[model samples]
Target chain A: MPNLYQEVIFWALFAITVFSALLVVGQRDMFRSALALIVTFLAIAGIFAQMNAEFLAVAQVLIYVGAVSVLVIFAVMFTKDMPHSTRSTNLQPVSIVVVGLLFIALSWAIFQSQWNEMPAELPVFVESTLVDSSSQLGTAIIRDYVMAFETVGVLLLAAVVGALALVRDK
Target chain B: MLERYLLLSVILFCIGLYGALSRRNIIAVLICTELMLNGVNVALVAFSRYSTPAFMRLTSVDASDSVKVLDGQAFAIFVVVVAAAEVALGLALVIALIRSRNTTDVTEINLMGN
Candidate 1:
Protein backbone atom coordinates (compact mmCIF):
# COMPACT_ATOMS: atom_id res chain seq x y z
CA MET A 1 0.00 0.00 0.00
CA PRO A 2 2.91 2.33 -0.35
CA ASN A 3 2.07 5.47 -2.33
CA LEU A 4 3.83 6.33 -5.54
CA TYR A 5 4.96 9.73 -4.32
CA GLN A 6 6.63 8.16 -1.31
CA GLU A 7 8.62 5.87 -3.55
CA VAL A 8 9.67 8.73 -5.78
CA ILE A 9 10.70 10.89 -2.86
CA PHE A 10 12.62 8.02 -1.32
CA TRP A 11 14.59 7.35 -4.47
CA ALA A 12 15.28 11.05 -4.97
CA LEU A 13 16.61 11.39 -1.45
CA PHE A 14 18.70 8.28 -1.86
CA ALA A 15 20.30 9.69 -4.98
CA ILE A 16 20.95 13.04 -3.33
CA THR A 17 22.46 11.48 -0.21
CA VAL A 18 24.82 9.33 -2.22
CA PHE A 19 25.78 12.06 -4.67
CA SER A 20 26.46 14.65 -2.01
CA ALA A 21 28.51 12.14 -0.01
CA LEU A 22 30.61 11.46 -3.08
CA LEU A 23 31.06 15.16 -3.60
CA VAL A 24 32.08 15.58 0.00
CA VAL A 25 34.88 13.06 -0.36
CA GLY A 26 35.87 13.55 -4.00
CA GLN A 27 35.91 17.32 -4.32
CA ARG A 28 39.29 19.01 -4.01
CA ASP A 29 38.10 22.44 -2.91
CA MET A 30 37.23 22.69 0.74
CA PHE A 31 34.46 25.20 0.05
CA ARG A 32 32.86 22.94 -2.52
CA SER A 33 33.05 20.05 -0.09
CA ALA A 34 31.29 22.14 2.53
CA LEU A 35 28.58 23.01 0.01
CA ALA A 36 28.13 19.33 -0.76
CA LEU A 37 27.85 18.61 2.94
CA ILE A 38 24.99 21.12 3.10
CA VAL A 39 23.20 19.34 0.29
CA THR A 40 23.75 16.03 2.06
CA PHE A 41 22.29 17.47 5.23
CA LEU A 42 19.25 18.77 3.36
CA ALA A 43 18.69 15.43 1.71
CA ILE A 44 18.85 13.71 5.09
CA ALA A 45 16.25 16.19 6.29
CA GLY A 46 14.07 15.08 3.41
CA ILE A 47 14.51 11.50 4.54
CA PHE A 48 13.42 12.50 8.02
CA ALA A 49 10.34 14.08 6.50
CA GLN A 50 9.55 10.86 4.68
CA MET A 51 9.91 8.95 7.95
CA ASN A 52 7.15 11.20 9.39
CA ALA A 53 9.42 12.85 11.96
CA GLU A 54 8.29 16.30 10.86
CA PHE A 55 9.78 18.09 13.82
CA LEU A 56 13.15 16.41 13.36
CA ALA A 57 13.07 17.19 9.67
CA VAL A 58 12.63 20.88 10.36
CA ALA A 59 15.21 20.83 13.14
CA GLN A 60 17.68 19.08 10.88
CA VAL A 61 17.23 21.80 8.30
CA LEU A 62 17.47 24.65 10.79
CA ILE A 63 20.20 23.26 13.00
CA TYR A 64 22.57 21.19 10.91
CA VAL A 65 22.06 22.70 7.48
CA GLY A 66 21.55 26.24 8.70
CA ALA A 67 23.80 26.56 11.74
CA VAL A 68 26.45 23.84 11.73
CA SER A 69 27.17 23.99 8.00
CA VAL A 70 27.52 27.75 8.13
CA LEU A 71 29.88 27.48 11.07
CA VAL A 72 32.11 25.05 9.15
CA ILE A 73 32.06 27.27 6.08
CA PHE A 74 33.07 30.26 8.14
CA ALA A 75 35.87 28.25 9.68
CA VAL A 76 37.06 27.43 6.18
CA MET A 77 36.97 31.09 5.26
CA PHE A 78 39.01 32.12 8.30
CA THR A 79 41.73 29.57 7.48
CA LYS A 80 42.31 30.79 3.93
CA ASP A 81 45.14 28.64 2.63
CA MET A 82 43.35 25.28 3.10
CA PRO A 83 41.91 25.21 -0.39
CA HIS A 84 45.31 25.54 -2.06
CA SER A 85 46.52 22.12 -0.90
CA THR A 86 46.94 19.39 -3.53
CA ARG A 87 46.77 16.44 -1.18
CA SER A 88 43.31 14.98 -1.73
CA THR A 89 43.92 11.23 -1.47
CA ASN A 90 42.18 8.13 -0.24
CA LEU A 91 43.20 6.07 2.75
CA GLN A 92 45.61 3.14 2.41
CA PRO A 93 44.36 0.13 0.45
CA VAL A 94 44.47 -2.16 3.46
CA SER A 95 42.43 0.24 5.52
CA ILE A 96 39.95 0.65 2.69
CA VAL A 97 39.53 -3.12 2.53
CA VAL A 98 39.06 -3.28 6.27
CA VAL A 99 36.39 -0.59 6.14
CA GLY A 100 34.65 -2.39 3.33
CA LEU A 101 34.63 -5.59 5.32
CA LEU A 102 33.28 -3.79 8.35
CA PHE A 103 30.51 -2.27 6.29
CA ILE A 104 29.52 -5.68 4.92
CA ALA A 105 29.47 -7.20 8.37
CA LEU A 106 27.35 -4.41 9.79
CA SER A 107 24.90 -4.55 6.94
CA TRP A 108 24.63 -8.29 7.28
CA ALA A 109 23.90 -7.96 10.95
CA ILE A 110 21.22 -5.39 10.26
CA PHE A 111 19.59 -7.65 7.72
CA GLN A 112 19.62 -10.64 10.00
CA SER A 113 18.06 -8.91 12.98
CA GLN A 114 14.33 -9.56 13.44
CA TRP A 115 12.90 -6.09 13.89
CA ASN A 116 9.51 -5.73 15.58
CA GLU A 117 6.90 -3.86 13.63
CA MET A 118 4.79 -0.92 14.84
CA PRO A 119 2.15 -1.63 17.45
CA ALA A 120 -1.46 -1.85 16.32
CA GLU A 121 -3.01 0.07 19.22
CA LEU A 122 -1.32 3.41 18.70
CA PRO A 123 -3.22 6.30 17.16
CA VAL A 124 -2.72 7.06 13.49
CA PHE A 125 -2.42 10.83 13.78
CA VAL A 126 0.13 11.01 16.53
CA GLU A 127 2.07 13.46 14.39
CA SER A 128 -0.84 15.92 14.51
CA THR A 129 -1.26 15.64 18.28
CA LEU A 130 2.48 15.88 18.69
CA VAL A 131 2.74 19.03 16.60
CA ASP A 132 4.08 20.86 19.64
CA SER A 133 6.97 18.45 19.86
CA SER A 134 9.42 21.05 21.03
CA SER A 135 7.22 21.93 23.99
CA GLN A 136 6.71 18.30 24.86
CA LEU A 137 10.42 17.78 24.60
CA GLY A 138 10.98 20.83 26.77
CA THR A 139 8.64 19.46 29.44
CA ALA A 140 10.37 16.12 29.42
CA ILE A 141 13.74 17.78 29.68
CA ILE A 142 12.75 20.04 32.53
CA ARG A 143 10.80 17.46 34.51
CA ASP A 144 12.56 14.15 34.14
CA TYR A 145 15.81 15.01 32.37
CA VAL A 146 16.43 18.40 33.91
CA MET A 147 20.02 17.71 34.83
CA ALA A 148 20.91 16.58 31.34
CA PHE A 149 19.19 19.58 29.83
CA GLU A 150 21.01 22.01 32.10
CA THR A 151 24.27 20.29 31.34
CA VAL A 152 23.72 20.75 27.62
CA GLY A 153 22.86 24.40 28.17
CA VAL A 154 26.03 24.93 30.16
CA LEU A 155 28.00 23.13 27.49
CA LEU A 156 26.65 25.39 24.78
CA LEU A 157 27.41 28.44 26.89
CA ALA A 158 30.95 27.23 27.44
CA ALA A 159 31.31 26.63 23.72
CA VAL A 160 30.20 30.19 22.89
CA VAL A 161 32.57 31.71 25.45
CA GLY A 162 35.41 29.50 24.30
CA ALA A 163 34.83 30.32 20.65
CA LEU A 164 34.88 34.04 21.41
CA ALA A 165 38.09 33.68 23.36
CA LEU A 166 39.72 31.68 20.61
CA VAL A 167 38.80 34.18 17.92
CA ARG A 168 39.49 37.33 19.88
CA ASP A 169 42.82 39.18 19.50
CA LYS A 170 45.30 38.86 22.30
CA MET B 1 12.27 0.37 0.51
CA LEU B 2 13.73 0.50 4.00
CA GLU B 3 16.62 -1.57 2.81
CA ARG B 4 17.46 0.91 0.09
CA TYR B 5 17.46 3.80 2.56
CA LEU B 6 19.58 1.81 4.96
CA LEU B 7 22.06 0.94 2.24
CA LEU B 8 22.47 4.55 1.23
CA SER B 9 22.97 5.65 4.82
CA VAL B 10 25.62 3.00 5.39
CA ILE B 11 27.55 3.94 2.27
CA LEU B 12 27.48 7.62 3.11
CA PHE B 13 28.63 6.88 6.63
CA CYS B 14 31.55 4.76 5.49
CA ILE B 15 32.66 7.44 3.07
CA GLY B 16 32.50 9.97 5.85
CA LEU B 17 34.54 7.75 8.16
CA TYR B 18 37.16 7.28 5.51
CA GLY B 19 37.40 10.99 4.99
CA ALA B 20 37.66 11.70 8.69
CA LEU B 21 40.41 9.14 9.26
CA SER B 22 42.39 9.62 6.09
CA ARG B 23 42.19 13.29 5.16
CA ARG B 24 45.00 15.60 6.26
CA ASN B 25 42.95 18.81 6.11
CA ILE B 26 40.84 19.73 9.12
CA ILE B 27 37.96 21.06 7.04
CA ALA B 28 37.73 17.84 5.09
CA VAL B 29 37.70 15.87 8.30
CA LEU B 30 34.92 18.04 9.71
CA ILE B 31 32.82 17.59 6.61
CA CYS B 32 33.25 13.84 6.90
CA THR B 33 32.17 13.92 10.51
CA GLU B 34 29.02 15.76 9.52
CA LEU B 35 28.35 13.08 6.95
CA MET B 36 28.62 10.37 9.58
CA LEU B 37 26.26 12.28 11.85
CA ASN B 38 23.71 12.54 9.10
CA GLY B 39 23.97 8.79 8.58
CA VAL B 40 23.11 8.21 12.22
CA ASN B 41 20.14 10.57 11.96
CA VAL B 42 18.75 8.64 9.02
CA ALA B 43 19.02 5.35 10.86
CA LEU B 44 17.30 6.75 13.92
CA VAL B 45 14.28 7.98 11.98
CA ALA B 46 14.08 4.84 9.95
CA PHE B 47 14.05 2.69 13.05
CA SER B 48 11.46 4.96 14.61
CA ARG B 49 9.16 4.43 11.67
CA TYR B 50 9.78 0.74 11.73
CA SER B 51 8.77 0.50 15.36
CA THR B 52 5.73 2.77 15.11
CA PRO B 53 2.41 1.08 15.89
CA ALA B 54 0.68 2.31 12.79
CA PHE B 55 3.51 1.36 10.50
CA MET B 56 3.63 -2.12 12.02
CA ARG B 57 -0.07 -2.65 11.42
CA LEU B 58 0.33 -1.36 7.89
CA THR B 59 2.90 -4.00 7.20
CA SER B 60 0.63 -6.54 8.96
CA VAL B 61 3.22 -7.42 11.58
CA ASP B 62 2.16 -7.95 15.16
CA ALA B 63 4.16 -5.86 17.66
CA SER B 64 3.91 -4.97 21.31
CA ASP B 65 1.80 -1.96 22.20
CA SER B 66 4.33 -0.70 24.76
CA VAL B 67 6.67 0.52 22.09
CA LYS B 68 6.93 4.29 21.84
CA VAL B 69 8.10 6.35 18.86
CA LEU B 70 8.90 9.56 20.70
CA ASP B 71 12.07 8.22 22.24
CA GLY B 72 13.87 8.01 18.93
CA GLN B 73 12.71 11.45 17.89
CA ALA B 74 13.81 12.91 21.21
CA PHE B 75 17.20 11.24 20.96
CA ALA B 76 17.65 12.61 17.44
CA ILE B 77 16.96 16.11 18.72
CA PHE B 78 19.51 15.64 21.46
CA VAL B 79 22.06 14.54 18.88
CA VAL B 80 21.36 17.60 16.74
CA VAL B 81 21.91 19.93 19.67
CA VAL B 82 25.09 18.11 20.64
CA ALA B 83 26.32 18.31 17.05
CA ALA B 84 25.84 22.07 17.08
CA ALA B 85 27.83 22.36 20.27
CA GLU B 86 30.52 20.06 18.95
CA VAL B 87 30.98 22.06 15.76
CA ALA B 88 31.30 25.24 17.75
CA LEU B 89 33.96 23.79 19.98
CA GLY B 90 35.74 22.02 17.13
CA LEU B 91 35.92 25.12 14.97
CA ALA B 92 37.27 27.11 17.87
CA LEU B 93 40.01 24.55 18.41
CA VAL B 94 40.82 24.51 14.70
CA ILE B 95 41.04 28.30 14.60
CA ALA B 96 43.29 28.36 17.62
CA LEU B 97 45.55 25.74 16.10
CA ILE B 98 45.71 27.57 12.79
CA ARG B 99 46.63 30.80 14.53
CA SER B 100 49.46 29.19 16.46
CA ARG B 101 50.88 26.87 13.79
CA ASN B 102 50.03 28.98 10.71
CA THR B 103 48.79 25.77 9.08
CA THR B 104 45.71 23.48 9.09
CA ASP B 105 47.21 20.28 7.82
CA VAL B 106 47.04 17.39 10.24
CA THR B 107 50.36 15.87 9.18
CA GLU B 108 52.18 19.15 9.70
CA ILE B 109 51.11 19.47 13.35
CA ASN B 110 53.73 17.01 14.60
CA LEU B 111 54.69 19.04 17.63
CA MET B 112 54.29 15.99 19.93
CA GLY B 113 57.97 15.10 19.25
CA ASN B 114 58.47 11.57 18.07
Candidate 2:
Protein backbone atom coordinates (compact mmCIF):
# COMPACT_ATOMS: atom_id res chain seq x y z
CA MET A 1 0.00 0.00 0.00
CA PRO A 2 1.25 3.49 -0.85
CA ASN A 3 1.78 5.95 1.95
CA LEU A 4 -0.65 8.79 2.45
CA TYR A 5 2.03 11.37 1.82
CA GLN A 6 3.01 9.74 -1.48
CA GLU A 7 -0.58 9.55 -2.60
CA VAL A 8 -1.15 13.20 -1.72
CA ILE A 9 1.96 14.25 -3.54
CA PHE A 10 0.90 12.26 -6.56
CA TRP A 11 -2.51 13.87 -6.68
CA ALA A 12 -1.10 17.36 -6.18
CA LEU A 13 1.47 16.91 -8.89
CA PHE A 14 -1.15 15.41 -11.14
CA ALA A 15 -3.44 18.38 -10.65
CA ILE A 16 -0.68 20.87 -11.25
CA THR A 17 0.55 19.06 -14.34
CA VAL A 18 -2.87 18.78 -15.92
CA PHE A 19 -4.14 22.23 -14.96
CA SER A 20 -1.05 24.11 -15.98
CA ALA A 21 -0.93 22.19 -19.23
CA LEU A 22 -4.48 23.25 -19.93
CA LEU A 23 -3.55 26.82 -19.10
CA VAL A 24 -0.62 26.62 -21.49
CA VAL A 25 -2.97 25.66 -24.29
CA GLY A 26 -5.99 27.76 -23.41
CA GLN A 27 -4.53 31.00 -22.15
CA ARG A 28 -4.56 33.87 -24.60
CA ASP A 29 -1.60 35.81 -23.19
CA MET A 30 1.71 34.35 -24.23
CA PHE A 31 3.32 35.39 -20.95
CA ARG A 32 0.59 33.65 -19.02
CA SER A 33 1.15 30.58 -21.12
CA ALA A 34 4.85 30.69 -20.34
CA LEU A 35 4.17 31.06 -16.65
CA ALA A 36 1.78 28.11 -16.76
CA LEU A 37 4.46 26.18 -18.58
CA ILE A 38 6.76 26.82 -15.62
CA VAL A 39 4.17 25.39 -13.27
CA THR A 40 3.87 22.36 -15.52
CA PHE A 41 7.65 21.94 -15.36
CA LEU A 42 7.64 22.12 -11.58
CA ALA A 43 4.90 19.54 -11.33
CA ILE A 44 6.85 17.23 -13.60
CA ALA A 45 9.88 17.69 -11.37
CA GLY A 46 7.74 16.70 -8.44
CA ILE A 47 6.79 13.56 -10.34
CA PHE A 48 10.49 12.88 -10.70
CA ALA A 49 10.88 13.19 -6.96
CA GLN A 50 8.11 10.69 -6.47
CA MET A 51 9.97 8.35 -8.80
CA ASN A 52 12.98 8.51 -6.43
CA ALA A 53 15.05 10.35 -9.01
CA GLU A 54 15.97 13.27 -6.77
CA PHE A 55 18.70 14.49 -9.08
CA LEU A 56 16.26 14.72 -11.95
CA ALA A 57 13.79 16.63 -9.78
CA VAL A 58 16.42 19.22 -8.94
CA ALA A 59 17.64 19.42 -12.52
CA GLN A 60 14.10 19.84 -13.75
CA VAL A 61 13.73 22.83 -11.50
CA LEU A 62 17.15 24.26 -12.30
CA ILE A 63 17.32 23.65 -16.02
CA TYR A 64 13.77 23.61 -17.30
CA VAL A 65 11.94 26.02 -15.02
CA GLY A 66 15.01 28.14 -14.30
CA ALA A 67 16.70 28.28 -17.70
CA VAL A 68 14.41 27.22 -20.56
CA SER A 69 11.25 29.01 -19.44
CA VAL A 70 13.22 32.17 -18.78
CA LEU A 71 14.84 32.05 -22.20
CA VAL A 72 11.47 31.66 -23.90
CA ILE A 73 9.97 34.48 -21.86
CA PHE A 74 12.92 36.71 -22.66
CA ALA A 75 12.46 35.99 -26.32
CA VAL A 76 8.81 36.79 -26.02
CA MET A 77 9.55 40.06 -24.26
CA PHE A 78 12.06 41.16 -26.88
CA THR A 79 10.03 40.26 -29.91
CA LYS A 80 6.36 41.00 -29.60
CA ASP A 81 3.67 43.14 -28.00
CA MET A 82 2.11 40.07 -26.43
CA PRO A 83 -0.74 41.83 -24.68
CA HIS A 84 -1.99 43.40 -27.89
CA SER A 85 -2.39 40.12 -29.74
CA THR A 86 -3.59 37.87 -26.94
CA ARG A 87 -6.40 36.14 -28.74
CA SER A 88 -5.64 33.40 -31.26
CA THR A 89 -7.90 32.11 -33.95
CA ASN A 90 -10.43 29.67 -32.57
CA LEU A 91 -10.47 26.00 -33.51
CA GLN A 92 -13.32 24.75 -35.61
CA PRO A 93 -15.90 22.37 -34.19
CA VAL A 94 -15.00 19.71 -36.71
CA SER A 95 -11.33 19.87 -35.80
CA ILE A 96 -12.17 19.68 -32.11
CA VAL A 97 -14.27 16.56 -32.71
CA VAL A 98 -11.48 14.97 -34.73
CA VAL A 99 -8.93 15.71 -32.03
CA GLY A 100 -11.28 14.36 -29.39
CA LEU A 101 -11.64 11.11 -31.31
CA LEU A 102 -7.89 10.87 -31.70
CA PHE A 103 -7.41 11.41 -27.99
CA ILE A 104 -9.84 8.63 -27.16
CA ALA A 105 -8.15 6.18 -29.50
CA LEU A 106 -4.72 6.95 -28.10
CA SER A 107 -5.94 6.69 -24.52
CA TRP A 108 -7.56 3.34 -25.27
CA ALA A 109 -4.35 1.99 -26.78
CA ILE A 110 -2.36 3.10 -23.75
CA PHE A 111 -4.92 1.51 -21.48
CA GLN A 112 -4.63 -1.83 -23.22
CA SER A 113 -0.82 -2.14 -22.90
CA GLN A 114 0.46 -4.62 -20.27
CA TRP A 115 2.83 -2.31 -18.40
CA ASN A 116 3.05 -4.22 -15.13
CA GLU A 117 3.73 -7.74 -16.38
CA MET A 118 7.38 -7.13 -17.34
CA PRO A 119 8.47 -5.42 -14.17
CA ALA A 120 12.21 -4.84 -14.11
CA GLU A 121 12.87 -4.21 -10.44
CA LEU A 122 14.73 -1.01 -9.59
CA PRO A 123 18.18 -1.32 -7.98
CA VAL A 124 18.73 -0.53 -4.34
CA PHE A 125 19.77 2.95 -3.20
CA VAL A 126 22.64 3.56 -0.72
CA GLU A 127 22.27 6.64 1.41
CA SER A 128 25.95 6.72 2.38
CA THR A 129 26.95 6.97 -1.27
CA LEU A 130 24.34 9.47 -2.34
CA VAL A 131 27.04 11.87 -3.50
CA ASP A 132 28.09 9.61 -6.35
CA SER A 133 25.14 10.45 -8.58
CA SER A 134 26.74 13.41 -10.31
CA SER A 135 30.02 11.57 -10.71
CA GLN A 136 28.35 8.46 -11.99
CA LEU A 137 26.36 10.55 -14.44
CA GLY A 138 29.53 12.32 -15.53
CA THR A 139 31.33 9.02 -15.98
CA ALA A 140 28.49 7.60 -18.00
CA ILE A 141 28.52 10.58 -20.30
CA ILE A 142 32.31 10.46 -20.70
CA ARG A 143 32.67 6.68 -21.07
CA ASP A 144 29.61 5.03 -22.49
CA TYR A 145 27.83 7.93 -24.19
CA VAL A 146 30.73 10.26 -24.74
CA MET A 147 30.05 10.91 -28.38
CA ALA A 148 26.41 11.79 -27.84
CA PHE A 149 27.29 14.05 -24.92
CA GLU A 150 29.90 15.89 -26.94
CA THR A 151 27.54 16.18 -29.86
CA VAL A 152 24.93 17.80 -27.62
CA GLY A 153 27.50 20.29 -26.40
CA VAL A 154 28.49 21.12 -29.95
CA LEU A 155 24.86 21.55 -30.83
CA LEU A 156 24.44 24.05 -28.00
CA LEU A 157 27.49 25.99 -29.15
CA ALA A 158 26.19 26.06 -32.66
CA ALA A 159 22.83 27.30 -31.46
CA VAL A 160 24.44 30.16 -29.56
CA VAL A 161 26.55 31.23 -32.50
CA GLY A 162 23.65 30.85 -34.89
CA ALA A 163 21.44 33.00 -32.65
CA LEU A 164 24.05 35.74 -32.61
CA ALA A 165 24.36 35.66 -36.37
CA LEU A 166 20.61 35.69 -36.81
CA VAL A 167 20.07 38.57 -34.44
CA ARG A 168 22.90 40.65 -35.85
CA ASP A 169 21.87 43.77 -37.79
CA LYS A 170 22.95 44.08 -41.37
CA MET B 1 -2.81 5.02 -10.13
CA LEU B 2 -0.73 4.44 -13.22
CA GLU B 3 -3.82 4.95 -15.30
CA ARG B 4 -4.44 8.36 -13.77
CA TYR B 5 -0.87 9.44 -14.39
CA LEU B 6 -0.93 8.16 -17.95
CA LEU B 7 -4.20 9.90 -18.59
CA LEU B 8 -2.79 13.15 -17.31
CA SER B 9 0.24 12.74 -19.53
CA VAL B 10 -1.91 12.15 -22.56
CA ILE B 11 -4.04 15.19 -21.84
CA LEU B 12 -0.99 17.36 -21.40
CA PHE B 13 0.56 16.00 -24.56
CA CYS B 14 -2.57 16.66 -26.61
CA ILE B 15 -2.90 20.17 -25.26
CA GLY B 16 0.63 20.87 -26.27
CA LEU B 17 0.10 19.33 -29.67
CA TYR B 18 -2.98 21.43 -30.24
CA GLY B 19 -1.16 24.57 -29.24
CA ALA B 20 1.71 23.74 -31.54
CA LEU B 21 -0.49 22.90 -34.50
CA SER B 22 -3.18 25.52 -34.13
CA ARG B 23 -1.53 28.62 -32.71
CA ARG B 24 -0.21 31.22 -35.09
CA ASN B 25 2.06 33.05 -32.64
CA ILE B 26 5.59 31.70 -32.45
CA ILE B 27 5.98 32.25 -28.69
CA ALA B 28 2.72 30.43 -28.07
CA VAL B 29 4.04 27.55 -30.12
CA LEU B 30 7.21 27.50 -28.00
CA ILE B 31 5.23 27.40 -24.80
CA CYS B 32 3.26 24.52 -26.25
CA THR B 33 6.47 22.67 -27.01
CA GLU B 34 7.63 23.08 -23.43
CA LEU B 35 4.33 21.69 -22.26
CA MET B 36 4.83 18.68 -24.48
CA LEU B 37 8.31 18.13 -23.07
CA ASN B 38 6.99 18.29 -19.53
CA GLY B 39 4.32 15.76 -20.41
CA VAL B 40 7.03 13.39 -21.60
CA ASN B 41 8.98 13.91 -18.40
CA VAL B 42 5.99 13.05 -16.27
CA ALA B 43 5.47 9.82 -18.15
CA LEU B 44 9.13 8.85 -17.88
CA VAL B 45 9.31 9.41 -14.13
CA ALA B 46 5.96 7.74 -13.62
CA PHE B 47 7.06 4.63 -15.48
CA SER B 48 10.31 4.59 -13.57
CA ARG B 49 8.51 4.63 -10.24
CA TYR B 50 5.84 2.16 -11.28
CA SER B 51 8.49 -0.36 -12.21
CA THR B 52 11.06 0.38 -9.51
CA PRO B 53 11.46 -2.22 -6.78
CA ALA B 54 11.46 0.38 -4.06
CA PHE B 55 8.14 1.70 -5.17
CA MET B 56 6.70 -1.73 -5.82
CA ARG B 57 7.71 -3.20 -2.47
CA LEU B 58 7.88 -0.10 -0.38
CA THR B 59 8.38 -1.82 2.95
CA SER B 60 11.23 -4.03 1.74
CA VAL B 61 13.44 -1.66 -0.26
CA ASP B 62 15.62 0.55 1.89
CA ALA B 63 15.28 4.27 1.31
CA SER B 64 19.02 4.99 1.21
CA ASP B 65 20.15 3.20 -1.93
CA SER B 66 21.02 5.68 -4.66
CA VAL B 67 22.63 3.63 -7.40
CA LYS B 68 19.48 1.65 -7.95
CA VAL B 69 17.65 4.89 -8.60
CA LEU B 70 20.11 6.27 -11.13
CA ASP B 71 18.64 5.02 -14.39
CA GLY B 72 15.49 7.09 -14.39
CA GLN B 73 17.29 9.97 -12.73
CA ALA B 74 20.00 9.94 -15.36
CA PHE B 75 17.51 9.84 -18.18
CA ALA B 76 15.68 12.81 -16.66
CA ILE B 77 18.95 14.71 -16.41
CA PHE B 78 19.74 14.13 -20.05
CA VAL B 79 16.25 15.17 -21.00
CA VAL B 80 16.60 18.37 -19.01
CA VAL B 81 19.93 19.18 -20.63
CA VAL B 82 18.56 18.53 -24.10
CA ALA B 83 15.52 20.67 -23.35
CA ALA B 84 17.72 23.53 -22.31
CA ALA B 85 19.66 23.26 -25.55
CA GLU B 86 16.45 23.06 -27.54
CA VAL B 87 15.01 26.16 -25.89
CA ALA B 88 18.18 28.10 -26.51
CA LEU B 89 18.16 27.17 -30.17
CA GLY B 90 14.43 27.73 -30.55
CA LEU B 91 14.48 31.14 -28.88
CA ALA B 92 17.44 32.17 -30.96
CA LEU B 93 15.57 31.24 -34.09
CA VAL B 94 12.56 33.18 -32.87
CA ILE B 95 14.71 36.22 -32.21
CA ALA B 96 16.22 35.96 -35.64
CA LEU B 97 12.82 35.63 -37.25
CA ILE B 98 11.46 38.59 -35.35
CA ARG B 99 14.42 40.70 -36.39
CA SER B 100 14.02 39.83 -40.04
CA ARG B 101 10.24 39.78 -40.40
CA ASN B 102 9.29 42.37 -37.79
CA THR B 103 6.51 39.92 -36.85
CA THR B 104 6.12 36.60 -34.98
CA ASP B 105 3.03 35.21 -36.61
CA VAL B 106 3.36 31.93 -38.49
CA THR B 107 0.87 33.12 -41.10
CA GLU B 108 2.98 36.18 -41.78
CA ILE B 109 6.31 34.40 -42.38
CA ASN B 110 5.84 33.63 -46.06
CA LEU B 111 9.27 34.55 -47.33
CA MET B 112 10.19 30.99 -48.41
CA GLY B 113 8.76 30.55 -51.87
CA ASN B 114 7.27 27.23 -52.89
DockQ of each: 0.46, 0.40
Q: Each model's TM-score?
A: 0.85, 0.81
- Over 4 Å off, model 1: A82-84, A88-91, A119-144, B52-67
> Could you tell me which residue pairs clash in candidate 2?
A122-B53, A123-B68, A125-B64, A125-B65, A125-B66, A126-B64, A126-B65, A126-B66, A127-B64
The local distance difference test score of model 2 is: 0.70
lDDT of 2 by residue, B1-114 (tens): 566667877888788877877787887887777777777776675664564434435656544333444545556556667777777777878877766667787766777854
Candidate 1 residue pairs that clash = A118-B52, A118-B53, A118-B56, A119-B53
Positional deviation of residue B107's Cα in model 1 after best superposition, in angstroms: 1.2
Return the lDDT, model 2, position B51: 48
RMSD in order of candidates: 4.3, 4.9
What is the RMSD of candidate 2? Answer: 4.9
Residue A74 miss distance in model 2 (angstroms): 1.4
Worst 10 residues of 2 chain A by lDDT: A117-126
Worst 10 residues of 1 chain B by lDDT: B60-69
What class would a CAPRI assessor give candidate 2's docking?
A: acceptable
lDDT of 2 at A148: 74
